[model samples]
Target: MKKKAFKEILKYVRVIVFFAVITILVEAVNYVMVQPGYARYIIHTVDNPDDGSDYDCIVVGASHGRASIDPHYFLEMEYAVNPINMCIQGATVIDNYYMIREACNNNDVKKIILELDYQYWNKNLKRDSDFGDLLVYGQLPFTSLKMEYIVSQLMDKDFRTIYFRRYAFAKNWKTAKKYMAIKKTDEYKNFQIEGVAGIETEGPYQGLGFFYRTKVTDKKGKLNPSPWTYDDLNPKVQKYFQKIVKYCKDNGIELICVTTPIPPSSVVSGAANEADTYFKQICDENNVRYIDGNLIKNEILNVSDDDFSDWEGHMNGELAEQFSEILTEILMKEDNSEYFYSGYDECIEAIKVRGNETKVLKYIRAAVFIAVIAGLVKCIDFAMMPSGYIRYIIHAAGNPGTEEGYDCIILGASHGRSSINPKHMIKSGYAKNPLSLCIPGESVVNSYYILKEACRNNAVKKVVLEMDYQYWTNDEARDSEFGDLFEYVQLPMSKVKLEYIRDELIDKDFRTVYFKKLAYTSDFSKVKYNIKTKLTKEYRDYDISAVKVCDANGPYMGRGFFYRENNNDHKCDFLVQEWTEDDISRKVIKYFQKIVDYCKDNHIEMVCITEPITPTAVVKGPSRDANTFFKDICSNNNVRYIDFTLLKNDVFDITDNDFCDWEGHMYGEAAERFSGIMSEVLANGNEEYFYDSYKAKIDEIERKKS
Candidate 1:
């Protein structure tokens, strides 16, 4: 019996150990994945006071208090209050109560200002699922109170969400890359939030927990108030509010409840009066002050729906400042009834929603109208967008491993597309099957994604990267042009595409991504043509001829090549793009390295090459620097560097006459010949066909031609 009992205990111990390890791993991943955001910043600010000064008053509530309360205003107006705003977005009464406790624990708080939004007091609402709640919970100091809070609030949430906080956020490989980089920083480790706070649409997060919202309501007077009744006051919320009151009383802290101003349109016809009466009676019972901003007449606080950021009545930054000033003035005065109406009915009579917008049918009609408008806008955006070469190339690539996948793929900008012929390479017995995935105006970063796109479908054994010095630029104007946007927009929806967007295009103007027409100036005359073309079966199937215009220089050739007609008599006056160490973009280096690394990881051979350019006047230092830069990169990565400009004139006789223009985009005949030569060299792995130096080749050509 004793031996059996011991064995049972051992079994339980083993199970516990297994779970402990799993729990540790889950927590570790959570630590890394959950980025340092506003919650961490705000909590750190209040919990660990930088000034080491006691706050005279601290505001605790949800987003309304966070945006509306400006503690600096009180200081500026010579009020004897040193305040900290501890309001959080989507914070419930429970969150507020804990925030109050946290503030009081850290510093000597003389008073508490609680902002009330009756919508948050709904009994049916589940607070655990809120990302805001999880963020705050994750940032809270590990204490008995925290444990209790976790048991009360977070126990019912998904274990993944509780342990791996990023589960609550949009989980993607790209977002992981972003946050992983963030995790490596000293700022993140030190819990610093100074430089990185707020988003593009939202204004900056001012210190002391105030968020200045820059966006105003576009809806104007058309607002949907969160309809609430007096009975909607949650029992749990009341319990916490009462706890906050009792805690404040025991600590000898003055408690003042204030309802931050909302647009009159957000106030349901009679709901405001119900909330006002209930809050007033409760505050009166607790012997605390209750001031409702909704009761403030239109004369003193002249605000409309325009002052708000949303229909829910979150004030914009400008309105917050104005309201803060008024709030400070009221706090200074002993009796502030002059600024406010006697009751909610009087306030509603003065400021009300325009027209009969409160009806249910009106709301339904408005929603339907907005939906229709959105759909029409999307249609217009789509119609105005032109079909570019990228769509053709991607479509031509076909699905993964389609029809005995190509072993070789060429990737780069237009030079590769126009110069190298996959057909000629195959004819010369170089590669069994190959595809040129090159795009016009493609950046090094874009080339990496193109390779990824190619590899996903085909069994890629080799990648030939065409180096264009002009495309290796850090300038946002140079890299994120319409061509780049076109390439991104055309890629099929896949993991690779999503990762590319998250990693590369997340920061680009969203309008450009969603509405491709916005990135380029559309010729209004072609609108009818474009819309008609897009509607065709050819366009839908990505027929190259459907979109391609047969210009003088070239016609669209299948397998991602544009066959250019030779212009032997064309003048060459354009300068050769000079490259220097100083001019080298870090973005170019990063993406180039990524390509090299990817090739290595996948066991695919990557060859770096520069296509022949017209030997125009060379800017002395940059020519040599360009050769050195590329050579060093290839050598460091143990890859071959082939500079076609350094090809021996005897081996491949090409001139300015062979190219369509000064950029050295080969005409069809010359391109075919070069492709044959490329195939021979690549098949034989011969370096003797090329000169040792770029400058030497340029000088020899210039000397011979002269």
Candidate 2:
């Protein structure tokens, strides 16, 4: 039994050793090239040998603290204590508490200056600490403090990223290459990191981050501020703030919580005042000193827009110098802590504990290998999904409804889709149940099947084909056309969807059919993280945005009915350009014939509609443009043709005011008016279709114009 146990122990030791070697190698690379922040912090710590011992006073906060506090201000004043501004952008109260905790563990500190911003409390949400901790963890040393923060605050994914250096460094390979090349520069080598736990680093103005741009306009000029009434304080921030107070009291470190000076443009109505009131209450409960900078801005301090970098609160170097002087005077007069942070040698102990290799951690090594492999597979599959915007066409194509009847179905591009409202059509008695299916930047080739599907099982009594000269000139594969997945991604995996893919996409865009993400890959940009987060994730439900036909109430009234509020901008400025249908894409002519044939075979009433454009659209009086061509085709085939392109006195007049949103779509009233006109035509049949001789009317108008 003893011999067997010894052998098992030896096996475990070997596994532990294998992981230790890999971890050391990964961490060594991570220290130099994992994340920009990681490299910056490690270098700062390595270069600046002194821990928190050098700084008797520390200023801690977010980007505001880094940019608005001048450490040299205290150094120049030659106060009883040395000070360092330890700030990073997006550092919240939880992060601030960790900074203090790390500082107390390593530094000789007499006082702690917390630079609080009201903007931090503006969010009513419980902060997404998983994300917030990304900024905090990169610079933190692997101490008990860091371990606790990681365990309690970080998500499993974040924990994996931070603890496993290889995992953290893999995603940013290209960045690592560039950083490795530039990281050895003079500024990087000489960069200073002050304060315990290395919270402070090199800055721009005399090595201070505090400064403002001279050419940039005051940001407040761009926004129209309105009163924002809400009393929901961020619960997590309050909890962390209390924890910071307790840490200060327990350590015998004097703490001063501050709300920094902010300009009017950066603050919404009464936000600053309310923030100050809340902060005052928190301070009173804990018996900590508090400074409300907004309350004394012009009276005690004369900072202006000229002194700020932007409207959202950051003071320039000159203003920071002045602010620091005032702050120092206040602290010197009021500070009560005489004893400094002198006992803890937690840094060495932390290094030892972090360095220790354990047997159980070997399983984490095995798990990392498995998780990484699994994640790679998931990412590849996720890239293949077409459930985003393409879902609209898929949902419509795969619609399981068997009712083979629609009073009318409008087919074209986005204009055709949005121009006609099904609810209004039904309510006005033009078409009992209408479905407007518009796909942006779609070719008529796609619409042929879309219309066929719309009419498949439904008793679509009428077909309204929306067309303009442009609809007949699709020569190129539009960037938005984005071939295959638009047809296949959203469709249910069945013979019908599969056949459509094989017929429409197999030879059409074969490469894109396989690697479709490349279809719009050229549009991808390396935007900043903050911006990309908002753009990609916000309001991104394609089903809600794309599907216009909703029978939620009495058929989705006023849902897709859109009109530009301050219209009447002579929207027909396109009249400035000459219109022509002399060049129609062969594809358009083919689809037009197909539509007519399909309608006739199905015994469906086809309305070959020339949708209204701006007044200067195709000159219709006597010209042989798309309108005349469509009219001629409809006349030969005995189909009803209704041309509504001109604002002529005889038939219909659509002006800029008639269009509510864009180039040629009608407003609600205009749509209703047009719907009424169509209803009259369909109801009256051949005798009342044009209300008079349509061809004779066109010839009369032409004769008069000539």
Clashes of each: 2, 10
Task: Please provide, for model 2 over 473-527, each residue's C-alpha lDDT reduced to its tens digit, 9 standing for 90 to 100.
Answer: 5445442336335544445555655666755564344435544444222322422
TM-score of each: 0.52, 0.45
**lDDT by residue (tens digit), candidate 1, 1-706:** 9999999999999999999999898877775566546667677778777777877778888888988988888778976457878887787888888888877778888888899888777764565455646756777888877887788887777766766776434376677567767667887767776423333345776766777888765845433344467667788788988999999999998888999887776664435667767888999998989988887767788887778877666888888988889998998888888998888766776665443445898789989987886787678866676766667778777653356688889998878988888877677676778899887678888888888888877888888888877776556675645645667777888998899878866656655666666434357887787788888898887776677443426776667777787656557557546556778788889989999999999999888888776655232324456666788889988999887767788988876677777765778887877888887777786789878876678678778877
Global Cα RMSD, each model: 22.0, 25.7
Residue 470 of candidate 1: its Cα lDDT?
71
What ranges in model 1 sit over 4 Å off?
1-374, 399-402, 481-483, 519-521, 550-552, 568-572, 576-578, 617-621
> Which candidate comes out best when scored by lDDT?
1
Poorest stretch of ten by lDDT in candidate 2:
339-348
- Assess each prediction's global lDDT (C-alpha) against the native: 0.76, 0.58
TM-score of 1: 0.52
Stretches of candidate 2 off by over 4 Å are 1-14, 35-54, 75-80, 122-129, 155-157, 164-175, 182-221, 224-232, 268-270, 297-300, 332-706
